[model samples]
Target chain A: MNIPMSEPITYLEAIRHAQTDCLHTDERVFIYGEDVEDPLGGAFKATKGLSTRYPERVLNAPISEDAIAGMAVGAALDGMRPIIEFQFADFAILAFNQLANHAGAGAWRHGQPCPLVARLPVGGTPGGGPFHSQMVENWLTTPPGLISVAPATVSDAYHMLKQAVRCDDPVMFYEHKALYFHQRASLSNAPEYPLGRAVVRRQGQDISLVSYSAMVWDALSAAEQLARDYQIEAEVIDLRCLKPLDMNTLYDSLEHTGRLLVCTEAWPYAGVSAEVIAQVSSQAFHLLDAPPRRLNAKDVPVPFHPHLWNAYRPNTADIVQAALDLVRF
Target chain B: MQKIPILLPRLGEAVAEATVQTWLCQSGDTVAKDQDLLEVETEKSIIAIPAPAAGVLLDIDKPAGSRCQVNEVLAWLHSNESDVVQPVDSGSPHAAPTPTETSPTHTPTASLASNSGRHGFLSPRLRALMQEQGLTELDLHLLRGSGQHGRIKADDLTQLLEHLQSHYEPHPAGMLRQAVADSMSRSWNRPLATVSSAVKMDALLAHRKTLPERPSASVYALSTLAQALKEDGRIAKLLLGDQLWQAQQIDLALAIDVDNGIYNPVIQSVDAYSLGELAVEVKRLIAQAHERQLPSNGHNTGIATVSNYGSLGITWATPLPPPGHSCLLGLGAVRRQPDWHPATQSWQCIRACEITLTFDHRIADGGTAARLIHRIVHLLEHPDLLS
Candidate 1:
């Protein structure tokens, strides 16, 4: 069913709709996580009415994240699609062995695809401390067989979630908690580009600003300010899929603007931002007029206080300063 | 009293940091605004940091020999006047005083010179473009780069090519003109000086009229210059670093004005030939230069050059010597001027012209140049000696 165009759909609603659509069409699909059953829904109310509508498919699990992931992997291997939800991205580490070793490498080792979707509530919020807010894409992406995607727009949140449910390989869907309510867009039924491709959120000429998830919004804002204040036009790219990075799109944008600045909400060390910069520096060195630079969240745990959290993550001002440095360089 | 920060202003585009060499004033010293507070040495030059406002220097944050980045606070000042301190924005780190607002006195040092004539860094894209266009470092040096530290960025190169594409129609300079331009640009790097003296050519003109084969004034001047160099061959030496290379022959090049360009084909051993033979050789060289048939072998290497710009009706001109040469002799147009003979007590019109000698000043000084011109003028005045 098409949602009414009169009201804009938020990132969280689009994700709920995508799961509902999957459950209605595909009988083999089911969602399993902590407190996800009826009356309680999920922690963030993402599966509010889903348990009541499809009681057999939506089941509640104990607080054992490892057991929850292990059961999903077993169900996926037995020709069933299982969607697992981690209360917060920081708690996903307890299931790292099952997600990375078993489900991720199952297709290559046993010639059987583990069609599992892990809905991770990632990124920072006002008071989500170190244990609640964390971007786990960098950890999940390092494994060989996982497909990690962070959707920034409501359209991608609606479409990519369904695409991940259909894919034979296991997918790590990192949905930014901050963008859940704040970001909204008109739900479009138009055909979507396949997963693992980047989208240019804004077109520019002076510099290329590459980011993903919630940082994509900040990059767009920074690009606007750069054009308005410094007369620097910054091209913004949202890397929808972090694992299968669309380097060709980056190369094309970098060819137009010889400068590049990447921003990420994750910490700086061995993360998505680092990977993007390293790839461009090695493969597309000739296209760069200035040294490629990246701005990441401060190398610290997600802060507890609101003011500290504001300073912990990379913001629009930081992005603008980084873009200015690259453009002026 | 309030404390104010004295920031290190930006030195240049390419200079990122500088070393605090010496402090002109100690702590507790009352300094005036714009007074030199300290000296810092950057990669480009030595610059003096000035006091932002008149105040007592509280203390130095960065001591001597310590390096600091641009806009870093060097020291603090305690001032009674609160208005003297400009309020800094705490919200934005980039909202600091610009270079113009904190005008530091820049004094360029001889230690770190500019890289105008020298080849600096070339970006990979710029290198590829240069290779594609068949351009060398000399051609690259001709372009003024707007990049950091005066580096020629690929954008600068492309912009220049685009400008040329839109603004001007390009015509290929053929082999002859290209060779001349290349050599002249190389020769222009030398410290060249020119000296000119008036010469009465009436005797030389009359002597030429008496001969069966009359030589042109350029031929006569060339012969005289060659003879004078033969007398003092030390003046024709080339200064190569700490040593001087002596010439093997007194060969001279005759500047021939061809269509669209000039050619200086060497006429070998001018002093060894008589006036008639020298005149014949000069005519043949001029014809060969006009037809662009001058030999490419070492026949172009000469000790000096003679340019007869007077043939084009120029009264006076200083012609430059070509590469591999030490000096150039230029002949000016002949003009009649009244001369007074004290014994006769009357003025009589006489034929006269100015002869200029342009030489590499590094090889010889002005006294030697003056003496050489004097010798050539003496020979030209006594036409019998030239014959």
Candidate 2:
């Protein structure tokens, strides 16, 4: 199947295309999640019209997230690839025991590969409130033996999801809801870069702005503003995979620019941004000219009002200010 | 009113006690925040202690001329608010305290203490770069940092190196030049002083003419200084920490100018050799130094060094001693001067030159240095004693 290179595709279309390709290539692959069947499709319309194409594989599950994740783990162990989708990332917390204890440690303890992918819609929209908008990638990534990935670009969104389906281990795929219809990119025949490798979205020298998911866009915009206003060139790195963190890419960028600033939309306490800083400070201590810092969302529940949510989440302006302070430092 | 103590901040790493120089504001005067309350003199410089907060100068605990240690309260200020009297610029030694509030919009202050290069708060990357390039903190004193509070950042060092590379062509110093530089830099750590006096060289010139083979003026001065050191070895004592180590032999080194740099070749026991033997030895060493063939371990154990800078047409010089040595004796160019003979009521031309002795002041005082230089001048004037 060839995706048209002439027209741009949204991040949501990239995920659907990836799932369609997986179902077409492999007969044993199936997707099981709440409201994923025909007509209604998934919660974000990611699986729209998929049930008509592959009716046997595209099936809906009961509304229990725990039962849905547990069934996927059992099916993966029984020699079938299964993909589970949570309507929102916040609901994935209900399946924590099944994902972390059963599927996460399946291969290590039982010596059998658990080829399952849990697609979680993460990050905020204008009125996502507390339940539908939380970024649960940090909690999913903390458990060992699980590969967690948050793709920011349309190409990575298409390529990395296909890679995750093929991977022998279980993978948690975090798709940013806010970027579904907002970001668009034309498909290319570029070879898929291996997972666990970070790409430099922009080349710079003054500081390294490391981020992933929706925060990568904010970091890129902040880099542009820094270059235009302060003459500070900020290198932006997109960490497509979070579990097997590509520290080498971060270290390489830090070698040129001794300052580092990590941005994430999650809360600060023990979040992905904090983990990045802790690892960089320990392993790449000598590469740092200034102390490595992180910019995270305010330590509060996702606000309901649009203006409150705007201030609660880390945005382009927050990233710009953090980068400037790091550059000056 | 809340009484806030104005403590003396740490001036520098080694400074302990400081003398209160003058009080800028009296006890009853009301001072604003950051206003100079008093000036204190440390060994490094005079620093003014500022009011930590806007208040009245309630009392002067340590008045002018009273010495105080670090963290000691020099005075007390009566502030209006008790809860908000935060110590501003508290850790920085020289910066005056200014009232600053922590606002939500302001950038959070970095947790690392801000320090200048001299304070030695070096980052790991900066330290690694310095180690790779064979540089110490003292060697990079001139590099100004753009980091917080004027701390030297790693980029500043790399930028300095890059600026040097683009602006100038670098030629790696030869081993001999590097050795000399290392020795001179180590010797410069001590407090060194030079004393000079003029010696009439007419007798020495006349005496050398009587001998079968004439010795160079440097060899004569080397021999004279060796004899004076042998008479009082205290003048050549090497100060190691608080103890002085006296030499067992009166060995001296002769500074010979080579192709790119100077070599100081040691002549063991100069008092043991006669004038003719010493002249031949000095000639051999000079030839070997010019050819860069001096034995590696043969030059560094001398107790003192004698430099004949007069050979370069220099009239007088205060040359530094080599590392591990305590003193250096330098001989200047000889000049023919008109002298009046009062006993015969006549004027005559005489040959005279200046002799300078540079000594490490940690081992000897000015009187000791002056006496040693006077003895050298005496021996040079009476050349028969040198033989």
DockQ-derived CAPRI band for the predicted complex in model 2: incorrect
For candidate 1 chain A, which ten residues in a row score worst on lDDT?
Answer: A320-329
Per-residue lDDT for B1-387 in model 2, tens only?
A: 556667777788888789999999899898888888899999989999888789898878898999997656688777875333233222222121222221112244332524333533577678878888888876677675555444667877887899989998988888889888888888998999999999999999988888776888987998899888888778778777788788888888888888888888888888898888898999889889888888765544689999999989998998999987889999999999988989889998899988888999898888999999899999999989875
- DockQ for candidate 1, C-alpha atoms: 0.19
Native A-B interface contacts kept, per candidate: 0.20, 0.39
- Per-residue CA lDDT of model 2 for A193-268, tens digit only, reads 8877899999999899999999999999998988886677899999889888999999999999888999888888
The digit string of per-residue lDDT tens for model 1 on B1-387 reads: 556778776688777789999999999999998899999999878999888778999879899999998656788887655344232211122333232243233212101112232443465556767888878777876675544334556677787889889999988988778888888999998999999999998999998888666889989988999899888876788887898999978888888899978887777788899998887887887778777787764744788999999899997997779977889999999999998979999999999999899989989899999999999999999978874
Q: State TM-scores per candidate.
A: 0.75, 0.80
* TM-score of predicted structure 1: 0.75
- What's the C-alpha lDDT at position B382 in model 2? 93
